[model samples]
Target: MNTIYRLLLVTLFFVSQNNQAQKRIALFNQKDLKGWYAFGEEKGKTNNADELFSVENNMIRMFGPKAGYLMSEQSFRNFELTVEYRWNTDVNVVRKNNNKNSGVMYLVPAETPDILWPKGIQFQIKEGATGDFVFLQETTLNINGTKTTPGKSVVSKRFADAEKPIGEWNQLVIISKNGVITQKLNGKTVNQGTESSVTEGRILLQYEGFPIDFRKVNIKKSK
Candidate 1:
């Protein structure tokens, strides 16, 4: 009888622990753009109307005219986000002479200004700067031990440069919890900030100029 009781208790403990584990959701379905919407210079326009954003060969390709972003329909907080991306080497006319620029923006509030970029914490994705942090609009972050002033934009430099070659894929991992944010590039921790003014909001994949491909955008929520 005691042996049976011990076995039941063990089973119950395992079940409880499993229930408390983090829940992961794949933001990209790898086949369609069902849970995402596009916003750009042409406000109120349809997503990928000009082929700026599309899913082909199991990857999300951003190639077309105008600069904008692809945003998630849902808001999130206290989660870890992982995405893999690579440059396409096809420059648009608008940014023909400039370096490739793009970013992954998160913690975007619902009331963000309806401009090319709203308020959020951006994981900088650009040539030679893949893991930097850009605080857009009025967002602020406490880097190291200094508290940044609000209502102004700031760029927090990454601790290191971890981008792969132009055409090679690189993985970006961002973890946000309790007002603290950490950014990793290619399996290395490159940047981190504390005391974020914005803690929860939507996610944005930027469309700066050159074409970029993204895959495996997944997020795991903390319990």
Candidate 2:
């Protein structure tokens, strides 16, 4: 009995160590876009791109002079991603929408062209509708016990609004494991889906013609 109890203690120690090993590291170094690039509709990607996306005060500032996505240099899978963002309405000289819009896109396949909207899962970032999931380019996800059709956008009308006031920081957590995905804003699981058609690919921060700031872009692998 003594030996069995000792073995069980050893097992628990290993389990705790393993959980600590799966550390959530900051993707943004708070210095520069070292491991990211830009792709957009115009004046971006495979051209002399302007500073539509820049790093300021340890936060990623999307000027949105041109609409585009700041693509990560690496692809990810089976991970939990967290980011803090706020609308910089103070810097917007030409705010496109009164309801400001942007998004965090994941599982963007590299084979597809970098159009305005590539095939991936988008956690839509918008006013009064921040937690909506936008399936782009025929992407699919099962939500609310119903299998969403290809190229369909399922509105999370049932989820409660979890966004902070404008200009205040809002934390968005996205967890994708196996084929299941969950979107949480301000600590609320506002949207979730299963059996996603997309499982692993690159991530993007959309610059949808609105000044925004993102910080603490961190990620950890999910079990």
Candidate 3:
């Protein structure tokens, strides 16, 4: 009887642990852009506007004239986000001269201005600058144990260059919990900060006058 009781208790504990570990949400449905909405200069103009944000070959492709972003309809907090992205070889005519630029913006407040860019912390995605941090609209962060207060756009360089070559997919892992945020690129920890002004909000993928492809936007509550 004693042995049976001990086995039962062990089984229950494993079941509880598995349940907590399996709490994950797929932000992008591979078939289509079901839970996302586009915002930019060309939004709501015509049916063709949707073409800017479309699912092609099981990846979300952003290619169009205007510069804007696709925002998640839901907000999240205290989670770990994983996504893969690659730069498209075709750049828009207007932005061809400049290096490609895109980003994953998170912790946007509810009252942030509805403009080309919102008030949030951005994981800077650019040519040779992946994993850099950008604080938009006076947002604040504590970097390397020091608090930063740039009046407008504050940029923090990543600790190392971990981006793969152009056209190859790179993985990004962003973990935000208890006001602390850490960014990882290609499985390397590149940047981390604490005491972020905004703890929770929607996620935004930027369309900074360049073409990009994204896949597997997955999130799960941090254990």
Give the alpha-carbon lDDT of every model: 0.84, 0.82, 0.84
Instruction: Give the TM-scores of the predictions, in the order they appear.
Output: 0.87, 0.85, 0.85
Give candidates' CA RMSD values in order. 3.1, 3.6, 3.5
lDDT per residue for candidate 3 within 135-164, as digits (tens), equals 988888999889888657889999998999
Per-residue lDDT over 1-223 for candidate 2, one digit per residue giving the tens place of the 0 to 100 score:
9999999999999898879658787788988887787886766574322255678799988764567878877788889999999999885355544558898999888787778878898999988789888888888888878877776454444276899999999999999999999999998988898999999988889888777889999988765
Best by TM-score: 1
What is the lDDT for 52 in model 1?
Answer: 44
User: In model 1, how large is the Cα lDDT of residue 150?
Assistant: 70
Off by over 4 Å in 3: 1-22, 44-51, 91-98
The lowest-lDDT stretch of 10 consecutive residues in candidate 2 is 43-52
- Estimate the lDDT of model 3: 0.84
Candidate 3, position 55, lDDT? 85
Model 1: residue 55 alpha-carbon error in angstroms: 0.5
What tens digits encode model 1's per-residue C-alpha lDDT throughout 73-163?
A: 7889899999999988754424423558999999998777546788999999988778989898878989989977675557888999899
